[model samples]
Target chain A: MEKKNTQQEIEEEIKSKGKDNIIKKIFSWILKNVKFLLIPASRLEELSIRQIEYEKKISKRKFIRRMKSTLTIFGMLLIFFIVTIAVFAPWFSPYTFDVLVGIAPGNYDPPSPAHLLGQGRLGRDILGRIIYGARASLTIALPSILFSLIFGVIFGVIAGFYGGWADSIIMRIMDILLAFPGLILAMVFIAMWGQHMEYIMLAYGIIGVPYYSRLIRSSVVQSRDLPYVQAAKVTGAGNWRIMFKHILPNCIQPVIISFTFDIGGIILSLAGLAFLGFSDPQLIEWGNDIADARLHLYEAPWGAFWPGFMILLAVLGFMLLGDGLRDALDPRLRNIYGAKKKKRKKGKKEENDSYEKK
Target chain B: MTLIEEKTEDSDRDPEVILSVRNLRTYYPVLGGLFRRKIAEVKAVDGVTFNLYNKETLGLVGESGCGKTTIGNTILNLVSAKSGEIYYKGVRIDNNFTNDLRKKIQMVFQDPDASLNPRWKIVNIIGEPLRILERMKKTREIRKRVLELLETVSMKMEHLDRYPHEFSGGQKQRIIIARALACNPEIIILDEPTSALDVSVQAQILNLLKDLQRKFNLSLLFITHDLSVVQHVADRIAVMYLGKFVETGTIEEVFYNPTHPYTRALLSARPTFDPTTKTSRVILEGDVPSPINPPSGCPFHPRCPKYLEQGKSMACSEDVPKKIHLGGEHYIWCNQTK
Candidate 1:
């Protein structure tokens, strides 16, 4: 049976792509040959789905066992609302992000049907600016966090896998970077390079590296000694394969959990930097809206209020989502809320099944 | 320091030595405080010497810290030897041996769950060695070889798509052994391969290992603390204590006519199946001493029964004992034998 299976596999693999373009043929061939790489990844995805199902079952039995708790539901709705506004901002508002509405610059308008949420000090539509502001905040925070995570994991894996002099040097550099407060260091980078959206993002990305690297390093140190890694070494794998293939995959869980929380924090800080004029003045961000309303504090309090409210809502949604992820991912907290007796019986049944299968 | 003469089972056949070690020592430094000063040293595998012959299973039995695992790791060069010489088929392997040697010497770790990569499917985990050492490219060929190996370990082809976590401990161990046998290695170091397994499954794995070894003529360095388990699988036994080999002999010599006091204690500790036989348990006086600051002269002298029986003589504390041959390959490190 095994022989026939292998024969069928070989035949399928060797099948030709008829009359295709040279590039198309090459792409198909590359894709076919890369089956070895794809199978493991697909299997990994399948295993992770099993893991998520297991976690869902555990978390359901424990605290707030519902598939979607009230808090999670609210958070999801808020995120959905924000994303909708960002995606269809033009449809929601009569004016563009920077264009004036109701009146010219240096004028303020209160809530009205034609221009809801009133007008900014520049007479631009507050609702439109707020919608576009969500786009800007999300784009900056997500990419910067991604940049930091990629670089952090690389440095951390290298430092953790090849200890001794390499670990010492990499950790020492991280220490020096960590010594300065992240926000202040980001401000320093903004000061060095003229203040712009990209520079602010670059600064945030640089500052985020040490935090993630340190997090990844600690986890890596614990996992590097696991017998699987030792087994990989015994198989004659080099340092690169051991670090990337074996160690990095296991170190990603805690990093992902931290990344969720860090995204909220980065959004808050990005708004703060813009408020402090570290970002380009021309960019229509929530922080820029609040900064513009500073002179009209008493006359147009609603100008700052709308933008401030959106920032609060966005940060709260992310924080709630982060908390939910932590609860789901952490095993100790996983089995806390459902009927203890029922869950224990189920667990016992599963254990027996595993035993019987063996 | 005169070397003890080693005897093979069939001396007339000009027995081939697959692996040999000379004065092997591995010490770890203990760093203290800021500036990282060398505060102390851990003599994990201090001055161990032995040889493994072709197609023979050499069991290394010892207590937890006696460095049995360390010796196994050192042989595979996983843990670097501080000062020693290792020869594989009379070819010296130092820090810079060619990668092909890795295919010749594979290892099966103790804990099956920890040994197999949890994120990987059975195919990748087992085919990894073939990919690295043999540089086999085609996925079909790798999959076919993986299936054959799994079958050798008594697993089916359907298991190829499953992840490590999906399998039971015994099945995971089968995958690990399959991985070790992937390159068709000449020698495999089974480092307590069955310690973490259930009693029934342990037997199954041992039998599988024996069958594969016989089929491939593979030499095995079986390291374990359980004497009974090793007895079933090992052809020769080396009794270790406090990071040194105290007794070396064939299974019959070690079990029937045990030489070293440590060996006797280890044997007595094994619970006999026939409980009505009424055998006296030779429990030692104290624990195995710390390897950091071992006893002067003889490392085992502090806990040695013979030393206590002889009134703790000054000679036992002052001088190291020489290796004394009993019969065949049996040798003991004791002053009485000398």
Candidate 2:
């Protein structure tokens, strides 16, 4: 019986045109209907679709409690301010971290005008170092975390899909890499590679790989089992296509969350390495400033406070963002929120069935 | 005296068959780490074969884990088969031809939520394969075709750009059907497509599937655990048990005068709407045995009501009964057939 359908399928294929035409048709429709294409334009004008996808739905009263538990407006603004300062450090601070702009190479008196946070051990402007350090820390952490995500996602994808000898080999390597504590491993690699910005990034990437690999690997395992993956396979999508197209999209949740934490961790680890006297002093980073200010902290407490405050804000911001994302993207949490504004109406038949059943 | 008299079996059905399987087997081995020792093999589909003729819906009905799903998956090569020869268009199907052969075949999965990728907009979900395999017209053409497909499936043109989450469960399934129809496939193997839906949604999807099948003249390999569903769709029925088919015949023959012992028990289990002729609700005692170490004789002999040993089936539980052909194409694998 399966034979006859093949004839009909062939005939239809021959008559109307090939699959390419069908695909073209869909694309054209989107182009023509571009106005509605943006969330509201489509036929799915159901109330749920109109809502911003990741917003958390909570009881109106309970909503206040949720916001209360997370970072407040002041904290968020502080984080944003710190990030902006770091991004615009060149414009914000006329002096580089090491550039002792003005103290006339003499009078390192009490906190006063001109030098806002005063000078440190090398008589470098403390304000200059703190602002420059934000730039230094962000560049280092963002790039380092990015490398980690890239290699980790690649390794994780391979391990999750193959699941046999290849999986064993890759996982064992991750286990070996994971044996050393993340900070210790980063320190060792930085020491071996010799301390350049690139070397530090390399160190952070290597050390962070195992965490993302394990995370993405687990996500891939779950995603591979979703019926859509199997459906893709039955429809003749190859292994690579299935891995990238079907399985990989679902793994984005954890990878995104880990990226937030990786940035924070990278900042701490890089600073810790710098404080341990590994970082080149010429770099004039957050950690180096903290180290320089340690001796005269009581006298020039401003030196310690600015650098410490900036570090706290950057780390806290990424974390809060990640926490907000976790609550929104996690399926269980989204279901709880159920978009309170509107409920979908049942079709006539469905309404009638319920009516009859009632 | 046979429930079905001898005269009617031999006269129906054509001699020519479209696709036929001999001894099909698909066993998934449960394993552990490192050395990867095979702990136990779940014989999801074991030693099953039946011919599928053209232009007919063959309902492969059985309880869950009875291997009806495995049979469909194996046929489509979704799950790797331990040993099976799936022929397509008189050609033996291996992994190589499986890709090209897929255009002719498609499957609608059980869960609409799990089956449709949430990230992909409706257009990509339907138009992706057109970009992959077939060489076709411009982007404008494919877009129009998709809208036409949406219209054909009773969906609006406006739904093209939205994501899967925007639609209701029924709409999701309709989009899934639109996607399946995109390849313009000849055979659609619906694996419990309606089971995950509400009754009202279920009726609509079923009706849509029927309408599409008739309109397009598509062949369907409808795999379902629900016996009531296949009645309207399948022209023929193949009742599966523990990875093997116990009965294969016309729908009328299987439902009206079910010959195989297991088939009869299953039929007996479905409550009759007729208030006058009551069914006893004969429960098949005990859980389905693990596929690893199945019973010695007939797999269903432990639960068979009409079974007799002759020392061949139940006695020493040694010799297994072969599939007995009782005229026409009404075949049954049971010791009592003789």
Candidate 3:
């Protein structure tokens, strides 16, 4: 019985030693592979620290304070109201934009309780058509402007960054585009492609490319020879990396300001084209409504007045926003908009202290 | 006299040559007329030759527009050399520098504000070299290396996220230095690195550069117009005049026994601190001649005081003088030197 007990104790000790070996092997594997996971984790922590620092230094709180100005606030509210009206047009509008409700004299009725913004000559509800027009106007303007911005930046960066032969070829093409009057060129494009909404937007988008390209090109030319560019070159950076990475970011501020302002201009152009019967007459656009109401203006003025006022409000909203962005983005003017001046002073004091310590 | 002899003998002993520029000439085309033709050529770096030894600082002192910066630029192939051969580690590199050679040689530009990209954070600016040359794709590894470089330059990790505009001029310069050192270059051409800083800041930068040189065993081509700064840091001095080396020597040889007339004029222009001893200043007459049409023979003949003292010798204007060796490594390109 005593020998059996001693044998059991030896087996248990051997079993425990094997378990210890397995544990050691697992720990060794983890020690070797854990850094890959830990590195990314540390990177995430560093990124958060960077974000926090950025917030402390260039606080969005200051941007909010600057945006509190009356003009910008008014612009934001106008845009907000227009977007809401467009989104809920099916629910909020009193009647279908196209269905007729009356005949003859009753169709051209002035502002009344049943028809709040009155009825059109075709007997469609004017308020409903105007509310729906916001959707059409935005769909055309936003896409067209975005298309122009993307293509224009590509052409401009290629021209300015490469210079020499590439510059000459691209710039000459842009010059040829600029030579023709914008509206006339757009009209010619629409005439060839047919008067559908998509074609009109495409024409407008093509017309805007040269203006943005030229603006970006001139600024890029000025910044291409800065000392930072030379520094990058010395570090073995290729031409593409220098052009897109270094030169583009520094010169993008002016492009952004121009981008905001160009949206307003494109919307006006789209309206002008619609008003001239360049679009399909069935489309319920603001300019199309204005055109149909012109003949009945003497009888029911609200028909012409409402659509024109909506157009004005859209354009004014974008223009005010552009002006506010210019004030915010320009570093020289940023201090006037409640940015903390004390940070710069502290930096200077630290510089002085370092100098003394040395 | 024996100490001076020993110094000359020490310089004569052959040191390793890391870079040698032979008869380098760089010209900039001047465009004019309606068709924008090349009307003339500005001789920016005209027929300059020198050898840079390993682990030494060669101070290049010249007035503004005398082509000191042009020489540095030409060596880095930033500008094409019209006629010359530049050998680095015994391999020809003019206009044919490989990516490896480019990694080995770097530059610190004069204006700190201009050298750094305003839009980039400090980490990206310094990490640029490590990314391109070292091919460090992992952000964690790059951040770690950049942190190490920043520490070498006495900057902290907290500065990694800030833009160039937020930093002071001295801080910007330190960041630029840190960027230059990221690739572990053997030679660094510093173009007036401290000229843009205040006097106290200048001293700090100079000392930092000295410490970095000792630590890295770097060969520095220090280009500046500040005589006192050069005197403090340079192992050897090369005095340039009108895109040419007028004199070259060990610092002791050039400082105490200047042979070239141009060298004498430049040294006398340095401000002395002692109030008791009155030293005569050699104020050079006339402005630096136009590089587009530099004067024949010696470029400095028109303003050379020694030329006037020698009663306007015909040799000064008619013929270019050859290099005259004054024992050891001391040499001057002046007919009146011997």
Candidate 4:
């Protein structure tokens, strides 16, 4: 009875403390942590305010970090502009593909006042075709890229997570898909079925499957044995929840790296497919421009040069951005982070030595 | 006491046995060769059984692979219980109870590193049960409750927005506790919650767990191989060997008067603070017998010191001893218990 009395006394003391006090305590903790953030503390936190701030402040690769901000701005602008132009294609364009504005092929029009990129073999203005083609090119590039990435990630996760027969079967399927090169398989696929965006998208997307699926699968397989995944299972989370939630997040490093790099590759593949006479006329694509300019290579070099320059800029821009992302997103790979660690260690050693001397 | 407090405590205080597991078995099948031929079953959890009261802490102790973790997993229906009936609150653990029972019973994993979803914010992790439990449409109330749970675990309200990797092991465990407490669960299975932390942090976490149990009137199934840790917090201690519980009783009962030889041997293995005192080391002959082909009869027979004379003259392999209850809820499964 006496023992019970003391327990109740202590319990009552805690209970009587108003709810306002509890909330106040919570608010004070938040304020203190935010202050800790301003000073720029350790690599990891005992706890954090949010993952974004944690990932942002904590994740820094010197060259990658330096380049990422600029690259992101450029990449986003390019993408955002492309998407905007594509969406408002009718309004944005000076003329559509059907509009017959300027020049005949035999006229051999120079950089004249009326026609900007001169005239192409088919007696169509070069500038008009390029502008009109933006919408069609985006249709092939955007959907193919997205669809491929999604398929690869899913396939990789499933293959990696479930090993043994499932793994062997899925891996073999990937191997077969990889057996035929992207261009060859795309040619084979497009030949049987006529050239359309869906076939081109499906072809490009299928090629990216093995890359992402393997990358994601390996990460998932490695992370499957981690303590956190086991904990989730023990905590009553179903298998699917654990796979998509606990395991997927840890394995995102590979996906992010592959995403940027593959965007450029997908664009190149679409261009290659178009170069091989697989694209539609109304598509208004750069590849189609280059293709049409093949016969006029000797007469007007600018006919080939203009379309080729745009292709080079687009592919090269994405490639540089991909390199920036790969470096910035991974802290361990950055040389700048090593210097920072060394500096911190030296300072800590100096402090310890001075204290010991005293 | 207030109405809800008085009501919950009143019901929990009654010594109503909630679960009575009988002869539980879980053996993982091992396959070998290029063709993946069946080899043998790793008897991770051989026959094991125990009774659990509504409001009590049952500490399960055993070496790694001895099936303490497997038992907890099996009880929670994480792994299939191959052959056994696990009654939960007088209802058998099955597909329905396994699903619906999650609201009443929860688990805290050993590794803080992996238990939580790294992508999910703490608020989402804690409030998941609240959303899934029923057609409850009180998001704000649930958030408030999650905040309260964080406070209960001595974490700040701001932690609600953070991910799992942001915290240290101790802090992560606290977040896990907050999540477990969200459903207002009656029982929480703690799978070595302190084993993954440093020695200094272990005490703080253990104290927090004890405090939480008292405050919430919760029953806990604490699985750990550390006998001393179990001794400190457990009301009842069950000693397992080769996937079977050989001895069980109140902490005082088991420590003061151990019946099974394995239990006595386990107690001797615990490192004492006094370096000078040589508590005879229990160097068990040979490594633990492979679970794939465990010795016939009592799984403990190959290692039991008193199996020759004290036990039955009949083949020690032939007869596996059954559990016999002594007075005051003390139970032992050894033939030597007689």
DockQ of each: 0.49, 0.28, 0.43, 0.23
Regarding lDDT, does 1 or 2 come out ahead?
1
The number of the candidate with the highest DockQ is 1
**Per-residue lDDT for B43-147 in model 1, tens only?**
888777788899999999998988989888888888888887777887777465567888999899989888887667789999999999999999999999999
Q: Give the CA lDDT, 0 to 100, for residue A8 in model 2.
A: 84
Task: Give the per-residue lDDT of model 4 (tens digit) for B41-120.
Answer: 88888877677776789999989889998888888777787786677766677444554688777888888877777656
Instruction: Kindly report the TM-score of the first chain in candidate 1.
Output: 0.67
The 10 consecutive residues of candidate 4 chain A with the worst lDDT sum are A53-62
List model 2 lDDT by residue over B73-94, tens digit each: 8777777677756666667774
lDDT of 2 by residue, A315-335 (tens): 777777666555544323333
Docking class of 4: incorrect
Per model, the share of native interface contacts recovered reads 0.75, 0.53, 0.71, 0.43
Provide C-alpha RMSD values for all models, in order.
8.4, 9.4, 9.6, 9.3
- How displaced is residue A147 in candidate 1, in Å? 2.9
Stretches of candidate 1 above 4 Å error?
A1-93, A97-108, A291-358, B1-15, B311-315
lDDT-best of 3 and 4? 3
Q: TM-score for the first chain of model 3?
A: 0.70
Docking class of 1: acceptable
Q: Summarize candidate 4's per-residue lDDT along A32-75 as a digit string, tens digits.
A: 67867676754245444333333543444134454556665586
Candidate 4 or 3, higher DockQ = 3
Candidate 2 accuracy as TM-score = 0.81
Number of the candidate with higher TM-score, 3 or 4: 3
Q: Which candidate has the top score in TM-score?
A: 3
In model 4, the Cα lDDT at residue B295 comes to 75
